[model samples]
Target: MGLQVNIIKKLPGFELRVDFKADNDILGFLGASGSGKSMTLSCIAGIVTPDSGKIILNGRVLFDSENKINIPVRERKVGFLFQNYALFPNMTVEQNIGFGLLKSISKVERIDKIKKKILDLQLNGMEKRYPYQLSGGQQQRVALARALVVDPEILLLDEPFSALDEHLRNSMILQLKDDLMGFKGTSIFVTHNMEEAYQLCNNIIIIAGGSIDAIGFKDAIFNSPPTLCAAKLTGCKNISKAKKIESNIIEAIDWGCKITFNYEVEDSIADIGIRAHYLEIMVDDEDVNTFNCWVVFTSETLFRTKVYLKFSEPIGDEKDFDILWDTSKEEWDLVKDKPLPLKIRINPEKVIQINRN
Candidate 1:
């Protein structure tokens, strides 16, 4: 089955207006904090009421503001995995998982479901332990088991791995990916981590300022973000104000550079974006779109080096308008002993045209 959401809710500083549809594939809501990603999920789960619009899951109406029909939270049949894995502190793992089924199921059936869930989630031995007594990974598994045991029609994960350490988070993501293979219902994953969204989601909805900035498949959205906010959210490091100079040319004002495109340049393009990795070191100054930049600073990460460079010409009074260039350690090592002033070329095909009005 699938999900259809078109809702509006008013918040203190912003108004949440989202409209999207997704099938059984995992959909990721990618946005920064205070972007109303969690609020959208809450509205679908019936945890919060929306000011207007509709929510339909598998042809079943969950909320409809016009009809004044809002399903109760318990009756929505949605599996919500909170960020903190909200498990009852006093209950055991088995009790927590079977808690949702106790009302409508017999003791034998409830025990069978709990046993199957524990086996499915690989929590067989720690069935009697409480949430505080288990490790982060184990606790996450228990939360997933509890959510799935009720046979919910949809699953909503709100930064499910945010509470875990890096090592545990990676391991649990692998485990969760495996577990999701057998889930028959639609799943919505909410997170600000671009890498996580790229790895797990088939479709992505980017939220910015309490609205959907862009929505598309994972590869398309990452390769060509439609807006300035989308580009920044998708990890584009270099963005500048652009003015269309010709049918296939645009002047990047902030970087003091003019870029020519092989494709048709739209008149509505207001910004230009280039990924850090897409820029290459130029061997000669005659190359197209190549400019000499002053090296401002350099930093190292686990596997790559980040070089920050400033344009030769300053734009207005902003002297710190720098472009970030990312290169592999091996590549950087080859150019590490090179001279101070470096010339870099921006790949024309890698240049992203953004329309953010």
Candidate 2:
């Protein structure tokens, strides 16, 4: 079964127009805050009504604008896992899971089915526990079990692991990935984390300014984003303006010198963006595009080290650039305060030069 969304809505000072399709794959909606990612999910879940268009799930028309066909949320057979876990506090875990099955099956049958689901989610012994009794990870698992207990046709998870600690979040993400194995139905997962989006979804859709900026396979969308905004959204920290010098060469004038890259720019306005990981820190040598840069500052992160550098001379009124390096603690310490000129390797394709109008 697949999910299709062709919808339009006009919000205060913003218009959301989204069109996408997904098969049984886990599709991720990636966008920054206020970019309408959450709003799109709400519309699909029937929580927000769209001004126009249709939503179809598994051949069932859930919302059709022309015919005024809109299904109630209860009848949609969609399992929505909210960001807050949203477990009913008054009811025990078992009761909350079995709540939806009451009308479909007898008490005994519902209890038995819920018990199986609890075991499936590894929450068997937590049956009588309240929401307050479980840890964040356990509570999230219970929430998933509760959603699956109803045997919903599709699963919609909205920032499912945002509330957990780092360790717990990673563990829960792995668990969720495992749980999706037997789920043949489609899933729409919403998140702002680029790593999470890349790790979880087969197809990634990025939204910006209430519209789709880019959408494709995880690698394609991140590695070759369609616009400067898309590159920035996908964790590109080093972006510079460039002008075409020849057919297959573009010169970045702002990066200390006229660094010619092995890329063609047909558009008059072109911007090149490179991820920090792609940058290097070493002495400037005979490398084709090498330039002199001085280390101005350095900082360390959990997994990588970052160093900010400034150019020897101003170029196009731009004074400096920052280059981040991902290295071990020992490696970072060796160059902690050293003044060095670095040669950075550039992959022509990875260095995205966006054509702006």
Candidate 3:
């Protein structure tokens, strides 16, 4: 079973018009806060109604504006794992997992089902613990078990690991991956973290300004972002204005260099985007477009080193540009002593240029 949404909605300051589809796949809803990610989830879960359009899931009509058909939230049979890990404070973990089955299943069957789910989540010994007695990760696992105990047709997770610290978040994400592999059901996950989206999702839908900014596989969406907004949201740190001189000739005002790309820009107005990871400090023998730059500042991360570069002349608003380069301990030892001038190159094909609408 999968999810489909072709919907339009209007609020005081936002307008949402999105059309998307997914198979029995893990679909990610990615956007910054207030970008309609959660609102879309609510609409799917029947907590919010759209002004018009239809929501079809698993060959069933969840909401249809034309037919004036809408299923109540309780009847949707959709599992929603909320961001807050909404477990009952008074109930133990097992009781919480077995709550929905109270009237439907026999007491013995209910206990068996709940115990099976607890074991699936590796929470075997924590069944008697209350919500307050568990850690954040444990509480989230219990919430997930409760959602799945009903054997929901589709699963919806909203920022599932946002509350955890970095280490715990990574661990939970891996656990969730394992659980999903074992469960093998359709899921829609909403998150704002790009790394999370890349790591967890099979497909990505970026919502910006209440509309679907872009949608596709992780590589397709990130490799060739359809718009400036999509490129920015995907962490394309360097976006510069460029004027096309001819089919492959363009002049970048920020870099003050007229270069010919190996690829063609078919648009009249283009915003060139370069991801920080694709750029590097220029070496002496580099044949690419070499620019003279002075290191303004530097910071090291676990994965890469962030170097801020200042051009010989001011380059518009981006006078200081950030370049991320992978470094080893030996390289760090050699380069960390003093400020050094740098050179960087960007692959032309990697330089995505989005045309303004």
Candidate 4:
């Protein structure tokens, strides 16, 4: 079954306006902190009330402001996995998983249900363990099992791996994806991370300034962002104020360079965005769209080096560069000893036109 939400929430200093539908897909809410990501989930789960909105899940009216129908949280049939996992420290894993079952269930039936979930989630040996005794991943699985045992019509997760370490976060993402695959209802995953959202969600909704800036398939939103906020949220590192120079050319005000595109430049395009990994290293600066750049500095990750570059001509910030080029660590090692004035190029087809909308 699908879920539909069109809601407006008014907080002290922030207002959230979002409207979207999920056709039983893993819908991702991608936004920075305090961007109303968690609040939206709360509203849908009946944990928080919206000032005015309508929420229908699996053809049931969970909330409707005009109709004055606000279903109770327990009756909404929505499963919520909190950021902290929120496992019961006093209760054992088996008790936690079975806690959501209906009160009318027989004791023996409940025990069998919990045992099946323990086997499915691979928590059999740790059934009697307390929350503190389990690892972060195991705790997460217990929380997930607890949420799913109720057979909710929709599942809402708010940064489920926020507390895990880096290695655990990676593995937990894979686990979460696999676990969600078995869920037959609509699932919503909220996070500030673009990579994690793209990896776990088939459809993504970019939240900005308390509103949905963009919503579509994961690839479409990443490939062509409609607004500047959408571009930045999707991990586009290089976005510049653009001035249309000609039908096929536009000047990137922040990068201090003119780029000639193969396609006609639309007037509604107010900015341009380029993914860091899409940039290319150039042998010389004479090629089209190629420019001489000063390698300001570099930051290293586990296997990649993010190079900060500035144009030879100062048009943007003098102290901070506006362009970033991500290269492999092996490639950076070969050029770390080289001199300044490193050349780089931007492919015209790879450039994303950010519209005013």
TM-score of each: 0.95, 0.91, 0.90, 0.95
TM-score of 2: 0.91
**lDDT (0 to 1) per candidate:** 0.90, 0.81, 0.80, 0.90
Tens digit of per-residue lDDT, candidate 4, span 238-315: 999998989999999988899998778898778998999999887787778998888766799989999998887444
Looking at model 2, the pairs that clash are 282-342
193-261 per-residue lDDT for model 3 (tens digits): 988888889899988988888888988888888888889888887777888987887777776655567
Query: In model 4, which regions exceed 4 Å deviation?
Result: 313-318
Tell me which residue pairs clash in candidate 1: none
Candidate 3, run of 10 with poorest lDDT: 318-327
Error of 3 at 134 (Å): 1.0
Cα lDDT of model 1 by residue, 3-23, tens digit: 999999998879999999989
Task: Give the 10-residue window scoring lowest on summed lDDT in candidate 2.
Answer: 313-322
Task: Tell me the tens digit of each residue's lDDT in model 2 across 42-131.
Answer: 898899999999999999999999999999887888888889988999999998887766485787888788989898889978989999
All models, RMSD in angstroms: 2.1, 2.8, 2.8, 2.0
Candidate 2: misplaced stretches above 4 Å? Answer: 102-104, 262-269, 313-327, 336-339, 345-349
Clashes of each: 0, 1, 1, 0
